[model samples]
Target: MKFIDSAGVEFNCPVTFTGTVTTTPSSPATASYMVKRWVSPTITQADLTGGQASQSVNLTGFPGGVVLAASYLQTTATSSSSNGGTTGATLSLGISGSTQAYLATGANVLGAAARLSNAAGTLLGTYRASDVPQVTITATGGSPDLAHLTLSCRAVVYYLEVTAES
Candidate 1:
C-alpha cells in the first residue's frame, strides 16, 4: 500500500504510486511538474484595409514557450479591381524584430501554404501570449498593388512549456 502524507503534494504531485512490495514508505519520488499549451491567432480580412502595399501577420493570444514544429500558415488574397500585378512575395517569421530567426526571408510565402517545422528549425527564444509571434509578409518581385485587394491570413503556432529552463 502507498501512503501520502497530509493528503497533498507540493506541486500537486500524483496521489497514486507504483511499487512491487505490499508495504511502502510515506514519502516517495515526486514527479516533476510541467505545463504545455498551444495558441493560434489569425488576422481576418476585416482587420485589413482595402489598399495596402505591405502588412504584418501580427496577432494576439499566443503563449511564452519554446516553439514547436507543428506550426502552420494559411493565406489567400483576391482583388476586386485587380491583383495589382503581384507576382512574388517575401515571408519572414520570428520573435519580434528578429524576423529571420525562425523562417528566413524570401521563404516562398505565395506558394499556396507554408509551415514552420523542425525541418527548418530556427527557433531562438520564448514568445509571449500578449504579443503573439509576428510574421511579416512583405510583397516583393514584380509590382505588388494592394488597391481594392482583400487578403486573409491565418497562422497556427505550437509551443511547449517546461518546468526547468533547458
Candidate 2:
C-alpha cells in the first residue's frame, strides 16, 4: 500500500505479511505480517547573528510519521574584531530551553563545524514534528567598538518515520 499527503506527495511503504491460514478439513499454516513505512529525509536551515539571544528553528506542522533523525550546525559567514581585548568570539548549539552544547568556537575567526550528537551517535534529545531547536553565538569580549562581531548560521536536520514495531 502507498500513503499520500494532501500535496500529493507519496511516501515509501514496504510491507510483509505472516499469519495462519486454515483450509476446511485440512491442515493450518502459520504466518506473520509486517509493514515498513518510511519518509525521505526532511531538512531545515536557519541563519543567526552573533552576540544575540538564542535563535530558534521551529519544525512545527511537519507531516506526521516523521521524527528528528540528525542535525548539523556550521558558520556560513562571520565577522569579528579583537576590540583590543583578550578573549575571542564563540558559537554554540543546543536544544531549546536546555544547556548549550559543550562544543564551542574560539578566537575572532570562525571555528570548525560543530557536529551535534551524543556519544551514541544520536542527537541530544528526542524531537517530534513540532519541536524547536536553538543556536547561540557569543560576541567577542572587548570594547563594543572593537568587539563588534556577527555570524550567520546554517542548520540542517534530517527526519525519518518511526518503525511500526517501535
Candidate 3:
C-alpha cells in the first residue's frame, strides 16, 4: 500500500550504481572487460581515422540511482597505438546531460535523469536524454611497442538504497 497526492500522486526515488577500475603492467598487452551497458571483447574507434582497436569496452543503460566510486589503472594503456607500452593511461569519464556531456568526479555515477560523478562519493554532474557517458584513455610515461598488444578491462558494479526519508 502507498499514499497519494491530489488524487494519487506517487514518486520514485531512483536506482543508482557505482564502481571503479584499476590497471597494471602486464605482458602480451591484452585487456577486455564489461561494465554497466558495455560488454567485453570490444574495440574502440579511432577519432581521426575512424579505425577500431581491440582494447576498449563501453557500458550503457543504467537503472537510475547508480554511482561509480573510482577507476584505477593497475596495468593498462591509454591508446591502442601505444598498447603494451610502459606508459600509463589518463582516463576520463563523461556523463550525459540535457544537451551536453558532464565529467564525473571519482568514477562514474548513473542516477535518475542520468547523472555522473567522480568525487569519491558525491554527485559531479547530471545528464538528460540524447546524452551518453564516454570514457577516454590517454597515454603517459615511457612508450613501448604497444601496437601488438590487446586491451581489456574488469568491471565491478555496486548498489545502494535509501529506506526512509530523514
Candidate 4:
C-alpha cells in the first residue's frame, strides 16, 4: 500500500505478512490476506510578520489524531543606526490560548538575528486529538526604532492511520 500526505510526500507500506487459510467443510473455501501499514511524517509552515505587538498563525485543516511532533520559530531583525540607544526586542512563541513555549531576545545592536525552539527549553509534546494548535508570536520591550523585522514559524507533525482487517 502507498500513502500520500498533503505535502505530496509518498510512502510505501511493505507487506510484512502474507498467508492463506482454508476452512473445514465438505468443500473448503480458501482466503488470502496481507498486512501492510506505516507511519509518515508531514510538515507545514506558517510565516509571521514582525513589527506588531502580537501576531498569530491559524493552522486550519490540521489533521486530527496526528501528533504535533515538533515546532520552532525563526526570526530576523534589521535595525537602522537610528535604533541606536534603543532597547532590544524580546520575542516569544506560544499556543494561541497558552503560555509561551519559547522566548528569544534580540541584540541591542543593529542587524541582529535570533532563533528559538521549544526543543530543550519547553518542549511542546504531542498534541491532543481535541486540541487545535494555533501558534502565536509576541514581541515586547522593543523600540520602534528598528527598521524592519520578520518572523517565520514552522511545525512538524507525524501521524499514521491503521486499516482494520477481519
Candidate 5:
C-alpha cells in the first residue's frame, strides 16, 4: 500500500530501518526497506524487526499516513592500500550531516558536523567527505577499495502533515 494523504498536504513523512550490509555484490546499494509509521516522535529498531527488505511500511498509530519513499546505504571496507586486495581491514568511520537540515549535502553537511552518535549520544564516527551520505562510501584514491565494505544505516523522514481523507 502507498502512504499518501487524502487531503494532499505535504508532510515530513519520515521512516527508518536497520539491517546488516549484505556481502554479495547483487545487493543494491540503496535497499528500499519498509517501516512502521507511528504518530509518536520515536520508533525503536525493534519496530522494524522481522519486516521484509524494501517492504512498504504500514502505519498503526498513524493509520491515516502512507509510506512513500525510503532511503539508506550499505558499504564494505577494503584492505589498506599497502595490501594487494587480500584481507579485510577495519578503518575509522566518519559521517557529517546537518542536525538542522536533512537534505544538506557536500560541505554543507560536512560543515555542520552533524554526525552519527552512539546510543548514548557519544560520537562514534564523524562525517567526512569520504563517507557517502545516503548513497556514497568515501575512500582514499586507489589505496583502499570499498569492496564488501559493511556498515549499518538508519533513515528517518518527517511527516509534513496529515489529512482525514484522501
Candidate 6:
C-alpha cells in the first residue's frame, strides 16, 4: 500500500521503527500503539509579538499507557528567517503538564527556517499518557517580531494504550 495526502493538506510522517519490533500479548488489546494528528496554528508575528508564541495538543489515551514517539513536520515554509523572529528564534516539542520536559529534545526545534522534528539532545523517555502534548516557540532577536509571518505545520504523537493488568 501507499501513503496518501489529503487535498491541500499533508505531512506528519510516522516514526521509523527499527530494531526488534515487539508486540506483547494482552487482553482488551492493551499495550497497543496508536498515532494522532495535531494540526497547528500558523506561526505568525502575533505569536512572537511578545517575543514568544506557542501551540499545544491535549492527548487523550489510556492513563497507564505511555507516549511512544512524537514528531513535527513543517508543511509550508515561513516567510523568512522563520518560526518567530528574524533571528535567534528557537522551537521545542515535548509532552505537556507535569512531565513537560519528558521530551524536551532539541531535535524538534524550528531552525533558521521552519524546522521539522528536532528529536535530539534528549531521549523519548516515559511520557505518561495522562500528560498533554504540544510545542512552544520563542524569539530572541527582535521587538514585536515581524519576519515570522506565516509558518504552517503539523505534529504527530505515537502512544501506547495500556492497562494495569496488561
Give the top-scoring candidate (lDDT). 1
Task: Please provide, for model 5 over 1-166, each residue's C-alpha lDDT reduced to its tens digit, 9 standing for 90 to 100.
Answer: 2333447744566634376423322232443333332122222223333212211112223222332222211111211322343123221221233221222212211112223322211121222122222222232333444432223323333222222332
Global local distance difference test of model 1: 0.49
Higher-ranked by lDDT: 1 or 4: 1
lDDT tens per residue, model 4, 68-147: 33544444344223333333443343345653542222233234444345332243344345444444544434454222
Best by TM-score: 1
- Alpha carbon lDDT at 153, candidate 3: 32
Lowest lDDT sum, 10 consecutive residues, model 3, at 107-116
* lDDT for each residue of candidate 6 in 30-128, tens digit (9 for 90 to 100): 555444333444444444443333444333432335545455545355434544334544455555542234334343233334546554314254446
Q: Candidate 2, which segments miss by more than 4 Å at Cα?
A: 1-66, 99-129, 140-147, 163-166
Q: What ranking emerges by lDDT with the best candidate at the front?
A: 1, 6, 2, 4, 3, 5
Please list the residue runs of candidate 6 whose C-alpha ends up more than 4 Å from where it truly belongs after superposition: 1-64, 73-75, 79-85, 95-115, 121-123, 142-148
Per-residue CA lDDT of model 2 for 87-143, tens digit only, reads 444444445664353223333434433433422223433535444444445544443
lDDT of 5 at 87: 29
Q: Tens digits of per-residue lDDT for model 3 on 74-113?
A: 1123333334343443334444231112222233111111
Quote the positional error of residue 48 for candidate 2 in Å.
Answer: 7.1
lDDT of 6 at 37: 33
Which ten contiguous residues of candidate 5 have the minimum total lDDT? 70-79
Candidate 5: regions farther than 4 A off: 1-101, 105-134, 162-166
**Model 6 has how many clashing residue pairs?**
5
The per-candidate count of clashes, in order, stands at 1, 6, 43, 0, 29, 5
Candidate 1 segments exceeding 4 Å error: 1-39, 49-52, 65-70, 76-81, 106-121, 124-131, 147-149, 164-166
What's the TM-score of every candidate structure? 0.53, 0.43, 0.31, 0.40, 0.23, 0.48
Q: List the residue pairs that clash in candidate 4.
A: none
TM-score ranking from best to worst? Answer: 1, 6, 2, 4, 3, 5
State in Å the error of residue 93, model 3: 3.7
Superposed model 3: Cα runs more than 4 Å off: 1-58, 66-86, 94-121, 124-133, 141-149, 161-166
RMSD of every prediction: 9.8, 11.9, 16.8, 12.2, 18.6, 10.0
